[model samples]
Target chain A: MKRVLKLAALGACCLALCACANRPPAHALDRTCEMGGRHGATGVLEYQCVDGDGVIRERPQPIHRVISGGRNG
Target chain B: MIHRCPWPGEDPLYIAYHDTEWGVPERDSEALFAKLILDGFQAGLSWITILRKRENFLEAFDGFKPETLARYSEADIERLLGNAGIIRSRAKIEAAIGNAKAWLAMREGGQDFSDFLWDFVDGEPVQNRFASMKDVPAETQASQAMSKALKKEGFKFCGPVIVYAFMQATGMVNDHLVTCFRHDEVKALSRSS
Candidate 1:
Protein backbone atom coordinates (compact mmCIF):
# COMPACT_ATOMS: atom_id res chain seq x y z
CA MET A 1 0.00 0.00 0.00
CA LYS A 2 2.84 2.41 0.76
CA ARG A 3 4.48 1.81 -2.66
CA VAL A 4 1.17 2.35 -4.47
CA LEU A 5 0.66 5.69 -2.73
CA LYS A 6 4.11 6.90 -3.70
CA LEU A 7 3.53 5.98 -7.35
CA ALA A 8 0.22 7.81 -7.36
CA ALA A 9 1.83 10.97 -5.98
CA LEU A 10 4.59 10.79 -8.61
CA GLY A 11 2.00 10.41 -11.36
CA ALA A 12 0.12 13.46 -10.14
CA CYS A 13 3.31 15.52 -10.15
CA CYS A 14 4.15 14.38 -13.68
CA LEU A 15 0.66 15.26 -14.88
CA ALA A 16 0.90 18.77 -13.44
CA LEU A 17 4.29 19.30 -15.12
CA CYS A 18 2.94 18.07 -18.44
CA ALA A 19 -0.04 20.39 -18.21
CA CYS A 20 2.11 23.41 -17.55
CA ALA A 21 4.59 22.49 -20.26
CA ASN A 22 1.81 22.31 -22.82
CA ARG A 23 0.29 25.65 -21.85
CA PRO A 24 1.40 28.83 -23.59
CA PRO A 25 2.35 31.93 -21.64
CA ALA A 26 -0.51 34.31 -20.77
CA HIS A 27 0.79 37.09 -23.02
CA ALA A 28 1.37 34.68 -25.89
CA LEU A 29 -2.21 33.54 -25.63
CA ASP A 30 -3.40 37.13 -25.80
CA ARG A 31 -1.30 37.79 -28.89
CA THR A 32 -2.15 34.59 -30.75
CA CYS A 33 -4.67 36.11 -33.10
CA GLU A 34 -4.06 36.48 -36.86
CA MET A 35 -5.47 39.23 -39.05
CA GLY A 36 -8.52 37.66 -40.73
CA GLY A 37 -9.24 40.56 -43.05
CA ARG A 38 -12.20 42.95 -42.99
CA HIS A 39 -15.70 41.63 -42.45
CA GLY A 40 -19.37 42.65 -42.78
CA ALA A 41 -20.98 45.68 -44.41
CA THR A 42 -19.09 48.03 -42.16
CA GLY A 43 -15.82 46.19 -42.88
CA VAL A 44 -14.68 45.82 -39.30
CA LEU A 45 -11.38 44.07 -38.66
CA GLU A 46 -11.60 40.35 -37.99
CA TYR A 47 -8.94 38.40 -36.13
CA GLN A 48 -8.69 34.64 -36.23
CA CYS A 49 -7.00 32.56 -33.62
CA VAL A 50 -4.11 30.56 -35.10
CA ASP A 51 -3.36 28.92 -31.76
CA GLY A 52 -4.24 28.43 -28.08
CA ASP A 53 -7.12 30.47 -26.56
CA GLY A 54 -8.55 31.90 -29.77
CA VAL A 55 -8.59 28.46 -31.41
CA ILE A 56 -10.50 27.10 -28.46
CA ARG A 57 -13.11 29.84 -28.76
CA GLU A 58 -13.54 28.93 -32.46
CA ARG A 59 -14.82 32.37 -33.42
CA PRO A 60 -13.20 35.39 -35.00
CA GLN A 61 -12.90 38.35 -32.63
CA PRO A 62 -12.76 42.05 -33.21
CA ILE A 63 -10.02 43.91 -31.39
CA HIS A 64 -10.10 47.39 -29.86
CA ARG A 65 -9.57 50.54 -31.91
CA VAL A 66 -6.33 52.41 -31.31
CA ILE A 67 -7.36 55.85 -30.07
CA SER A 68 -5.14 58.65 -31.36
CA GLY A 69 -3.95 61.04 -28.68
CA GLY A 70 -5.11 64.59 -29.46
CA ARG A 71 -8.12 66.89 -29.53
CA ASN A 72 -8.86 65.94 -33.22
CA GLY A 73 -10.35 69.39 -33.67
CA MET B 1 -31.10 53.27 -38.70
CA ILE B 2 -27.97 53.86 -40.74
CA HIS B 3 -24.88 53.46 -38.57
CA ARG B 4 -22.13 56.06 -38.67
CA CYS B 5 -19.14 57.02 -36.59
CA PRO B 6 -20.26 58.28 -33.19
CA TRP B 7 -17.97 61.26 -33.23
CA PRO B 8 -19.92 63.00 -35.93
CA GLY B 9 -23.06 62.79 -33.79
CA GLU B 10 -26.17 64.40 -35.31
CA ASP B 11 -24.87 67.76 -36.46
CA PRO B 12 -25.65 68.21 -40.14
CA LEU B 13 -22.38 69.86 -41.08
CA TYR B 14 -20.39 67.37 -39.05
CA ILE B 15 -22.35 64.52 -40.56
CA ALA B 16 -21.79 65.89 -44.01
CA TYR B 17 -18.08 66.18 -43.45
CA HIS B 18 -17.92 62.74 -41.96
CA ASP B 19 -19.89 61.24 -44.81
CA THR B 20 -18.37 63.03 -47.74
CA GLU B 21 -14.95 64.40 -46.85
CA TRP B 22 -13.43 62.79 -43.77
CA GLY B 23 -11.26 59.73 -44.47
CA VAL B 24 -11.48 60.31 -48.21
CA PRO B 25 -8.05 60.31 -49.82
CA GLU B 26 -7.03 63.77 -51.06
CA ARG B 27 -4.16 63.50 -53.52
CA ASP B 28 -4.18 67.01 -54.91
CA SER B 29 -1.03 68.78 -53.75
CA GLU B 30 -2.70 72.14 -53.27
CA ALA B 31 -5.77 70.70 -51.60
CA LEU B 32 -3.56 68.63 -49.33
CA PHE B 33 -1.62 71.77 -48.39
CA ALA B 34 -4.81 73.65 -47.64
CA LYS B 35 -6.15 70.82 -45.46
CA LEU B 36 -2.88 70.62 -43.57
CA ILE B 37 -3.06 74.35 -42.82
CA LEU B 38 -6.66 74.00 -41.71
CA ASP B 39 -5.71 71.12 -39.42
CA GLY B 40 -2.90 73.18 -37.95
CA PHE B 41 -5.43 75.88 -37.13
CA GLN B 42 -7.55 73.15 -35.49
CA ALA B 43 -4.83 72.65 -32.84
CA GLY B 44 -6.66 74.26 -29.90
CA LEU B 45 -10.21 74.40 -31.22
CA SER B 46 -12.99 72.11 -32.37
CA TRP B 47 -12.92 71.14 -36.05
CA ILE B 48 -16.49 72.35 -36.45
CA THR B 49 -15.40 75.83 -35.46
CA ILE B 50 -13.01 75.87 -38.38
CA LEU B 51 -15.34 73.99 -40.67
CA ARG B 52 -18.07 76.56 -40.19
CA LYS B 53 -15.66 79.27 -41.24
CA ARG B 54 -14.01 77.29 -44.05
CA GLU B 55 -15.37 79.58 -46.75
CA ASN B 56 -14.05 82.60 -44.96
CA PHE B 57 -10.69 80.95 -44.52
CA LEU B 58 -10.52 80.05 -48.20
CA GLU B 59 -11.41 83.58 -49.19
CA ALA B 60 -9.11 85.16 -46.67
CA PHE B 61 -6.18 82.90 -47.45
CA ASP B 62 -6.45 83.37 -51.19
CA GLY B 63 -7.55 79.79 -51.87
CA PHE B 64 -4.46 78.59 -49.97
CA LYS B 65 -2.29 79.09 -53.01
CA PRO B 66 1.25 78.56 -51.82
CA GLU B 67 2.50 81.02 -54.43
CA THR B 68 0.22 83.72 -53.05
CA LEU B 69 0.57 82.88 -49.33
CA ALA B 70 4.37 82.71 -49.51
CA ARG B 71 4.27 86.41 -50.34
CA TYR B 72 1.85 87.51 -47.54
CA SER B 73 3.10 90.86 -46.25
CA GLU B 74 2.84 92.26 -42.74
CA ALA B 75 -0.16 94.25 -43.91
CA ASP B 76 -1.79 91.05 -45.07
CA ILE B 77 -1.04 89.50 -41.71
CA GLU B 78 -2.56 92.51 -39.97
CA ARG B 79 -5.59 92.34 -42.21
CA LEU B 80 -6.01 88.62 -41.47
CA LEU B 81 -5.71 89.24 -37.72
CA GLY B 82 -8.55 91.74 -37.91
CA ASN B 83 -10.79 89.41 -39.89
CA ALA B 84 -13.64 88.27 -37.67
CA GLY B 85 -14.66 85.41 -39.93
CA ILE B 86 -11.62 83.20 -39.42
CA ILE B 87 -9.62 82.16 -36.36
CA ARG B 88 -7.41 85.20 -35.80
CA SER B 89 -4.50 83.71 -33.89
CA ARG B 90 -1.42 85.55 -35.08
CA ALA B 91 0.80 82.57 -34.37
CA LYS B 92 -1.30 80.23 -36.48
CA ILE B 93 -1.48 82.83 -39.25
CA GLU B 94 2.27 83.22 -39.18
CA ALA B 95 2.78 79.45 -39.26
CA ALA B 96 0.53 79.22 -42.29
CA ILE B 97 2.63 81.80 -44.08
CA GLY B 98 5.82 80.05 -43.09
CA ASN B 99 4.38 76.70 -44.16
CA ALA B 100 3.50 78.17 -47.55
CA LYS B 101 7.09 79.32 -47.96
CA ALA B 102 8.26 75.87 -46.93
CA TRP B 103 5.88 74.36 -49.46
CA LEU B 104 7.18 76.66 -52.17
CA ALA B 105 10.71 75.69 -51.30
CA MET B 106 9.79 72.03 -51.57
CA ARG B 107 8.30 72.63 -54.98
CA GLU B 108 11.29 74.64 -56.04
CA GLY B 109 13.43 71.70 -54.97
CA GLY B 110 11.36 69.54 -57.35
CA GLN B 111 9.51 67.63 -54.60
CA ASP B 112 5.78 67.14 -55.00
CA PHE B 113 3.97 68.00 -51.77
CA SER B 114 1.38 65.21 -52.23
CA ASP B 115 4.14 62.71 -52.98
CA PHE B 116 6.08 63.85 -49.94
CA LEU B 117 3.11 63.28 -47.67
CA TRP B 118 1.90 60.09 -49.35
CA ASP B 119 5.36 58.57 -49.34
CA PHE B 120 5.03 58.06 -45.59
CA VAL B 121 2.28 55.54 -46.29
CA ASP B 122 3.97 53.98 -49.31
CA GLY B 123 1.78 55.94 -51.72
CA GLU B 124 -1.43 54.31 -50.45
CA PRO B 125 -3.91 54.65 -47.64
CA VAL B 126 -3.56 52.39 -44.62
CA GLN B 127 -6.91 50.70 -44.10
CA ASN B 128 -7.41 50.13 -40.39
CA ARG B 129 -10.61 48.48 -39.20
CA PHE B 130 -10.67 49.65 -35.65
CA ALA B 131 -13.84 48.65 -33.81
CA SER B 132 -14.16 51.82 -31.77
CA MET B 133 -12.59 55.16 -30.95
CA LYS B 134 -10.61 53.59 -28.12
CA ASP B 135 -8.64 51.40 -30.50
CA VAL B 136 -7.61 54.24 -32.76
CA PRO B 137 -4.13 55.30 -31.75
CA ALA B 138 -3.49 59.04 -31.48
CA GLU B 139 -0.10 58.63 -33.07
CA THR B 140 1.75 55.91 -34.89
CA GLN B 141 5.31 55.25 -35.99
CA ALA B 142 4.44 56.49 -39.46
CA SER B 143 3.06 59.72 -38.11
CA GLN B 144 6.12 60.18 -35.93
CA ALA B 145 8.40 59.76 -38.92
CA MET B 146 6.23 62.11 -40.97
CA SER B 147 6.26 64.72 -38.21
CA LYS B 148 10.02 64.55 -37.92
CA ALA B 149 10.38 64.85 -41.67
CA LEU B 150 7.96 67.76 -41.84
CA LYS B 151 9.73 69.68 -39.09
CA LYS B 152 13.03 69.04 -40.83
CA GLU B 153 11.44 70.57 -43.92
CA GLY B 154 10.38 73.64 -41.85
CA PHE B 155 6.69 72.92 -41.40
CA LYS B 156 5.39 74.01 -37.99
CA PHE B 157 2.61 72.67 -35.78
CA CYS B 158 2.99 69.33 -37.52
CA GLY B 159 3.62 67.27 -34.41
CA PRO B 160 3.13 63.52 -34.41
CA VAL B 161 -0.21 63.76 -32.68
CA ILE B 162 -1.45 66.43 -35.06
CA VAL B 163 0.04 64.56 -37.99
CA TYR B 164 -1.81 61.43 -36.97
CA ALA B 165 -5.12 63.27 -36.99
CA PHE B 166 -4.20 64.74 -40.34
CA MET B 167 -3.40 61.25 -41.55
CA GLN B 168 -6.83 60.02 -40.61
CA ALA B 169 -8.68 62.96 -42.12
CA THR B 170 -6.59 62.90 -45.29
CA GLY B 171 -6.98 59.12 -45.73
CA MET B 172 -3.32 58.35 -45.39
CA VAL B 173 -4.86 56.07 -42.81
CA ASN B 174 -8.48 55.02 -42.52
CA ASP B 175 -9.53 55.30 -38.85
CA HIS B 176 -13.27 54.95 -39.20
CA LEU B 177 -14.74 52.35 -36.82
CA VAL B 178 -15.62 49.05 -38.47
CA THR B 179 -19.18 49.57 -37.37
CA CYS B 180 -19.37 52.93 -39.04
CA PHE B 181 -20.97 53.04 -42.49
CA ARG B 182 -18.12 55.07 -43.87
CA HIS B 183 -15.49 52.46 -43.07
CA ASP B 184 -16.07 50.26 -46.10
CA GLU B 185 -16.88 53.17 -48.31
CA VAL B 186 -13.60 54.86 -47.46
CA LYS B 187 -11.73 51.63 -47.95
CA ALA B 188 -13.26 51.26 -51.40
CA LEU B 189 -12.27 54.77 -52.28
CA SER B 190 -8.73 54.00 -51.27
CA ARG B 191 -8.69 51.04 -53.65
CA SER B 192 -10.02 53.17 -56.44
CA SER B 193 -7.41 55.78 -55.77
Candidate 2:
Protein backbone atom coordinates (compact mmCIF):
# COMPACT_ATOMS: atom_id res chain seq x y z
CA MET A 1 0.00 0.00 0.00
CA LYS A 2 2.81 2.44 0.91
CA ARG A 3 4.53 1.67 -2.41
CA VAL A 4 1.36 2.43 -4.34
CA LEU A 5 0.79 5.70 -2.46
CA LYS A 6 4.37 6.80 -3.17
CA LEU A 7 3.92 6.06 -6.89
CA ALA A 8 0.69 8.16 -6.96
CA ALA A 9 2.48 11.09 -5.34
CA LEU A 10 5.34 10.81 -7.84
CA GLY A 11 2.84 10.76 -10.70
CA ALA A 12 1.17 13.97 -9.44
CA CYS A 13 4.56 15.72 -9.27
CA CYS A 14 5.40 14.64 -12.82
CA LEU A 15 2.12 16.01 -14.15
CA ALA A 16 2.69 19.35 -12.40
CA LEU A 17 6.15 19.71 -13.90
CA CYS A 18 4.89 18.89 -17.38
CA ALA A 19 2.09 21.44 -17.04
CA CYS A 20 4.58 24.14 -16.04
CA ALA A 21 6.86 23.29 -18.95
CA ASN A 22 3.97 23.39 -21.41
CA ARG A 23 2.61 26.72 -20.10
CA PRO A 24 2.88 29.48 -22.68
CA PRO A 25 5.02 32.55 -22.21
CA ALA A 26 3.36 35.65 -20.78
CA HIS A 27 2.33 38.24 -23.35
CA ALA A 28 4.59 41.24 -22.95
CA LEU A 29 2.99 44.67 -23.19
CA ASP A 30 4.02 46.61 -26.29
CA ARG A 31 6.70 49.21 -25.82
CA THR A 32 7.83 51.40 -28.70
CA CYS A 33 9.72 54.69 -29.06
CA GLU A 34 9.58 56.10 -32.56
CA MET A 35 10.42 59.14 -34.64
CA GLY A 36 8.47 60.95 -37.49
CA GLY A 37 5.93 62.63 -35.19
CA ARG A 38 6.56 66.41 -35.00
CA HIS A 39 9.65 66.22 -32.74
CA GLY A 40 12.30 66.66 -35.42
CA ALA A 41 13.00 69.88 -37.24
CA THR A 42 13.82 68.41 -40.65
CA GLY A 43 10.71 67.48 -42.71
CA VAL A 44 12.32 64.30 -44.00
CA LEU A 45 9.88 62.10 -41.99
CA GLU A 46 12.50 59.72 -40.64
CA TYR A 47 11.38 56.72 -38.52
CA GLN A 48 13.11 54.59 -35.85
CA CYS A 49 12.18 52.51 -32.83
CA VAL A 50 13.59 52.05 -29.33
CA ASP A 51 12.74 50.25 -26.11
CA GLY A 52 10.02 51.88 -24.01
CA ASP A 53 7.82 50.95 -21.02
CA GLY A 54 5.01 53.49 -21.45
CA VAL A 55 7.23 56.52 -20.77
CA ILE A 56 8.46 58.70 -23.65
CA ARG A 57 12.25 58.72 -23.68
CA GLU A 58 14.17 60.51 -26.42
CA ARG A 59 16.83 58.59 -28.31
CA PRO A 60 19.32 61.31 -29.27
CA GLN A 61 21.90 59.01 -30.85
CA PRO A 62 22.30 58.78 -34.62
CA ILE A 63 19.69 56.56 -36.28
CA HIS A 64 22.22 54.21 -37.88
CA ARG A 65 23.23 51.95 -35.05
CA VAL A 66 24.80 48.47 -35.11
CA ILE A 67 21.67 46.80 -33.61
CA SER A 68 18.91 48.93 -35.24
CA GLY A 69 15.88 46.65 -34.91
CA GLY A 70 13.06 47.95 -32.62
CA ARG A 71 9.37 47.43 -31.96
CA ASN A 72 8.28 50.81 -33.41
CA GLY A 73 7.49 50.67 -37.13
CA MET B 1 -2.84 81.24 -4.67
CA ILE B 2 -5.83 80.54 -6.89
CA HIS B 3 -6.77 76.88 -6.40
CA ARG B 4 -6.93 75.22 -9.82
CA CYS B 5 -7.18 71.65 -10.99
CA PRO B 6 -3.81 70.13 -10.23
CA TRP B 7 -3.96 67.90 -13.27
CA PRO B 8 -2.94 70.73 -15.57
CA GLY B 9 -0.10 71.58 -13.18
CA GLU B 10 2.25 74.42 -14.15
CA ASP B 11 2.51 73.75 -17.86
CA PRO B 12 1.34 76.93 -19.51
CA LEU B 13 -0.40 75.23 -22.40
CA TYR B 14 -2.22 72.81 -20.10
CA ILE B 15 -3.06 75.63 -17.72
CA ALA B 16 -4.55 77.53 -20.61
CA TYR B 17 -6.54 74.52 -21.72
CA HIS B 18 -7.90 73.97 -18.24
CA ASP B 19 -8.77 77.64 -17.70
CA THR B 20 -10.09 78.61 -21.09
CA GLU B 21 -11.44 75.60 -22.95
CA TRP B 22 -11.47 72.37 -20.93
CA GLY B 23 -14.93 72.46 -19.38
CA VAL B 24 -16.56 75.46 -20.98
CA PRO B 25 -19.80 74.61 -22.71
CA GLU B 26 -19.16 74.16 -26.43
CA ARG B 27 -22.33 73.95 -28.59
CA ASP B 28 -21.06 74.41 -32.14
CA SER B 29 -21.79 71.35 -34.32
CA GLU B 30 -18.47 71.16 -36.17
CA ALA B 31 -16.52 72.27 -33.11
CA LEU B 32 -18.03 69.52 -30.96
CA PHE B 33 -17.25 67.06 -33.75
CA ALA B 34 -13.68 68.29 -33.78
CA LYS B 35 -13.26 67.82 -30.02
CA LEU B 36 -14.79 64.33 -30.13
CA ILE B 37 -12.49 63.26 -32.97
CA LEU B 38 -9.53 64.70 -31.12
CA ASP B 39 -10.57 62.77 -28.02
CA GLY B 40 -10.87 59.63 -30.12
CA PHE B 41 -7.33 60.17 -31.31
CA GLN B 42 -6.28 60.47 -27.70
CA ALA B 43 -6.90 56.77 -27.01
CA GLY B 44 -3.89 54.89 -25.54
CA LEU B 45 -2.08 58.28 -25.30
CA SER B 46 -1.85 61.24 -23.01
CA TRP B 47 -3.87 64.41 -23.56
CA ILE B 48 -0.82 66.66 -23.27
CA THR B 49 0.77 64.95 -26.26
CA ILE B 50 -2.30 65.68 -28.37
CA LEU B 51 -2.55 69.23 -27.01
CA ARG B 52 1.01 70.00 -28.05
CA LYS B 53 0.34 68.62 -31.55
CA ARG B 54 -3.04 70.31 -31.90
CA GLU B 55 -1.68 73.01 -34.17
CA ASN B 56 0.05 70.57 -36.49
CA PHE B 57 -3.07 68.39 -36.54
CA LEU B 58 -5.21 71.40 -37.44
CA GLU B 59 -2.82 72.31 -40.25
CA ALA B 60 -2.51 68.77 -41.57
CA PHE B 61 -6.20 67.79 -41.34
CA ASP B 62 -7.51 71.10 -42.65
CA GLY B 63 -8.76 72.26 -39.27
CA PHE B 64 -10.60 68.94 -38.89
CA LYS B 65 -13.49 69.90 -41.18
CA PRO B 66 -15.91 66.95 -41.19
CA GLU B 67 -16.79 67.29 -44.84
CA THR B 68 -13.13 67.23 -45.83
CA LEU B 69 -12.08 64.47 -43.42
CA ALA B 70 -15.20 62.50 -44.36
CA ARG B 71 -13.85 62.22 -47.90
CA TYR B 72 -10.39 60.89 -47.00
CA SER B 73 -9.17 57.95 -49.08
CA GLU B 74 -6.18 55.64 -49.04
CA ALA B 75 -4.16 58.45 -50.55
CA ASP B 76 -5.15 60.68 -47.68
CA ILE B 77 -4.19 57.92 -45.24
CA GLU B 78 -0.75 57.72 -46.86
CA ARG B 79 -0.44 61.50 -46.67
CA LEU B 80 -1.36 61.46 -42.99
CA LEU B 81 1.04 58.60 -42.29
CA GLY B 82 3.74 60.62 -43.95
CA ASN B 83 3.00 63.63 -41.75
CA ALA B 84 5.14 63.75 -38.59
CA GLY B 85 2.84 65.70 -36.30
CA ILE B 86 -0.20 63.68 -35.27
CA ILE B 87 -0.33 60.41 -33.26
CA ARG B 88 0.62 58.46 -36.45
CA SER B 89 -1.35 55.35 -35.54
CA ARG B 90 -3.04 54.09 -38.74
CA ALA B 91 -6.00 52.69 -36.81
CA LYS B 92 -6.53 56.02 -35.06
CA ILE B 93 -6.20 57.99 -38.27
CA GLU B 94 -8.64 55.76 -40.12
CA ALA B 95 -11.10 55.94 -37.22
CA ALA B 96 -10.97 59.72 -37.27
CA ILE B 97 -11.91 59.84 -40.91
CA GLY B 98 -14.59 57.21 -40.42
CA ASN B 99 -15.99 59.21 -37.49
CA ALA B 100 -16.01 62.29 -39.67
CA LYS B 101 -18.08 60.43 -42.26
CA ALA B 102 -20.40 59.30 -39.48
CA TRP B 103 -20.69 62.86 -38.26
CA LEU B 104 -21.57 64.08 -41.75
CA ALA B 105 -24.18 61.36 -42.11
CA MET B 106 -25.67 62.37 -38.79
CA ARG B 107 -25.76 65.96 -39.97
CA GLU B 108 -27.39 64.99 -43.24
CA GLY B 109 -29.99 63.08 -41.26
CA GLY B 110 -31.08 66.45 -39.83
CA GLN B 111 -30.00 65.49 -36.30
CA ASP B 112 -27.73 68.02 -34.61
CA PHE B 113 -24.60 66.40 -33.15
CA SER B 114 -24.66 68.63 -30.07
CA ASP B 115 -28.32 67.81 -29.50
CA PHE B 116 -27.65 64.10 -29.88
CA LEU B 117 -24.87 64.25 -27.29
CA TRP B 118 -26.43 66.65 -24.83
CA ASP B 119 -29.72 64.80 -24.91
CA PHE B 120 -28.02 62.02 -22.94
CA VAL B 121 -28.50 64.22 -19.90
CA ASP B 122 -31.86 65.54 -20.97
CA GLY B 123 -30.30 68.69 -22.47
CA GLU B 124 -28.42 69.48 -19.25
CA PRO B 125 -25.03 68.73 -17.82
CA VAL B 126 -25.02 66.09 -15.05
CA GLN B 127 -22.83 67.73 -12.41
CA ASN B 128 -20.55 65.58 -10.26
CA ARG B 129 -18.81 66.94 -7.15
CA PHE B 130 -15.89 64.65 -6.70
CA ALA B 131 -13.23 65.89 -4.26
CA SER B 132 -10.15 64.74 -6.11
CA MET B 133 -8.88 63.40 -9.41
CA LYS B 134 -8.61 59.97 -7.85
CA ASP B 135 -12.37 59.97 -7.32
CA VAL B 136 -13.02 60.73 -10.99
CA PRO B 137 -14.05 57.75 -13.08
CA ALA B 138 -12.65 56.46 -16.33
CA GLU B 139 -16.18 55.58 -17.50
CA THR B 140 -19.75 56.00 -16.36
CA GLN B 141 -23.35 55.08 -17.18
CA ALA B 142 -23.75 58.10 -19.42
CA SER B 143 -20.53 57.30 -21.27
CA GLN B 144 -21.61 53.69 -21.80
CA ALA B 145 -24.87 54.89 -23.29
CA MET B 146 -23.00 57.34 -25.53
CA SER B 147 -20.58 54.65 -26.63
CA LYS B 148 -23.41 52.25 -27.45
CA ALA B 149 -25.28 54.93 -29.40
CA LEU B 150 -22.17 55.94 -31.33
CA LYS B 151 -21.32 52.31 -32.08
CA LYS B 152 -24.84 51.86 -33.42
CA GLU B 153 -24.14 54.75 -35.79
CA GLY B 154 -20.78 53.19 -36.85
CA PHE B 155 -18.58 55.67 -34.98
CA LYS B 156 -15.26 54.06 -34.14
CA PHE B 157 -12.80 54.34 -31.25
CA CYS B 158 -15.49 55.62 -28.94
CA GLY B 159 -15.30 53.28 -25.99
CA PRO B 160 -16.88 54.23 -22.69
CA VAL B 161 -13.70 55.77 -21.29
CA ILE B 162 -13.15 57.87 -24.41
CA VAL B 163 -16.78 58.95 -24.39
CA TYR B 164 -16.47 59.99 -20.75
CA ALA B 165 -13.51 62.17 -21.60
CA PHE B 166 -15.55 63.65 -24.46
CA MET B 167 -18.43 64.37 -22.12
CA GLN B 168 -16.14 66.16 -19.72
CA ALA B 169 -14.48 68.14 -22.50
CA THR B 170 -17.75 69.13 -24.24
CA GLY B 171 -19.60 70.03 -21.00
CA MET B 172 -22.18 67.29 -21.52
CA VAL B 173 -21.00 66.33 -18.02
CA ASN B 174 -19.02 68.23 -15.39
CA ASP B 175 -16.19 66.10 -13.94
CA HIS B 176 -14.12 68.84 -12.40
CA LEU B 177 -13.23 68.13 -8.77
CA VAL B 178 -15.02 70.17 -6.12
CA THR B 179 -11.76 71.49 -4.70
CA CYS B 180 -10.70 72.75 -8.07
CA PHE B 181 -11.85 76.29 -8.81
CA ARG B 182 -13.00 75.32 -12.28
CA HIS B 183 -15.52 72.88 -10.80
CA ASP B 184 -17.92 75.56 -9.61
CA GLU B 185 -17.21 77.65 -12.67
CA VAL B 186 -18.10 74.83 -15.07
CA LYS B 187 -21.16 73.92 -13.08
CA ALA B 188 -22.29 77.57 -13.22
CA LEU B 189 -21.87 77.59 -16.99
CA SER B 190 -23.95 74.43 -17.27
CA ARG B 191 -26.68 76.08 -15.23
CA SER B 192 -26.59 79.23 -17.31
CA SER B 193 -26.88 77.20 -20.49
- Candidate 1, residues B1-193, lDDT tens digits: the string is 7898887667898889999988999899999999889877765445666789899999999999999999999999999888888877777889999999999999999999999999999999998988877677767899999999999999997878678778888899998889999889899987545
Each candidate's DockQ score against the native complex? 0.01, 0.03
List ranges where model 2 is wrong by over 4 Å.
A1-73, B191-193
Chain B alone, candidate 1, TM-score of 0.98
How do the residues B1-193 of candidate 2 rate in per-residue lDDT, one tens digit apiece? 7887677778898888888787777888899888888877665445776789889888888899999999889999898887777767677788889899899899899989989988888888888888866677767888899999998888997877777778888878777778878888888887554
Please give the lDDT score at residue B77 for candidate 2: 89
For model 1, what fraction of the real interface contacts is kept? 0.00
Best lDDT among the predictions, by candidate number: 1
Query: What local lDDT does model 2 show for residue B129?
Result: 84
Candidate 2's error at B182, in angstroms? 1.3
- Chain A TM-score across all models, in listed order: 0.35, 0.32
DockQ of 1: 0.01
